[model samples]
Target: MIDKIAWLHLVDGRILSTRSRGKDVYYLPGGKREAGETDAQTLVREVREELTVTIELSSIEPAGVFEAQADGKAAGIVVRMTCFTAEYTGTLAASSEIDELAWLGYADRDRVSAVDKLIFDHLHEAGQLS
Candidate 1:
């Protein structure tokens, strides 16, 4: 299966997350890739479109890759989340299809998806989350 990767920014000890317009759960502020787009390109474009901020491509560093059952999809659906922590410019505002923005901690994992739970686990294990 093809993996979906995203660059997630952790700021001030909180991870940046978003919710879709009609969705109740929060998700990491990134999206799926387009054909022919490199991982860096996909990350930059997805983050910009969702958060209305320009992430410095050079500043982004690989955090981890997480996999889990895809949310609201078929049984075999799996997502590969390529995460990153980066410095960005511009105010973080909800743009495009994002309805709200949130800074979530490990305690908020229950409110996220299975894939995001794996991300939280990685962050906690790596001492990035408290």
Candidate 2:
């Protein structure tokens, strides 16, 4: 399995998502951990790298964990995504590696990766997403 950490930023019932350069699908704004990194560390680093924002470490909260077939990978490969919600500082802009930034709602589910679809569903069911 591939392990990843994701930042779940919700605004007006939409979630923050990103699409890396040359990638077709959008994804939640976070990424894989570097060696010896904690989830919080990885989250802060990834969000900063992808979204040009600083995640407030003390504001980090467990959102949920989700698993699904890794998009564009071999059929049997899966991804285990540990997610978090946190307050942040700075403007939310797509960084160099990112091609686009979007605030996606439940209706935009098909635009995201497999695991993000699950996140969208969860948020929608919880009435946190429209």
After superposition on all CA atoms, what RMSD does each candidate show versus the true structure?
Answer: 1.3, 0.6
Candidate 2 displacement at residue 51 in angstroms: 0.9
Task: List per-prediction Cα lDDT, in the order shown.
Answer: 0.84, 0.94
Question: Could you tell me which residue pairs clash in candidate 1?
Answer: none
Give per-residue CA lDDT, model 1, range 1-130, as digits (tens). 4476666677666788899999988889777889999888888898889888998988988878888888888899888888877888999999969989988999998989888998888887887766
In candidate 1 the C-alpha lDDT for residue 128 amounts to 76
- Candidate 2: how many backbone clashes? 0
**Segments in model 2 whose C-alpha atoms lie over 4 Å from true places:** none
lDDT digits (tens) for residues 1-130 of candidate 2: 9999999999999988899999999999888999999999999999999989999999999999999999999998999999999999999899999999988899999999999999899999999999
The number of the candidate with the highest TM-score is 2
Compute the lDDT of residue 44 as modeled in candidate 2: 97
**TM-scores of the models, in the given order?**
0.93, 0.98
Q: Tell me the deviation in Å of residue 10 in model 1.
A: 1.5
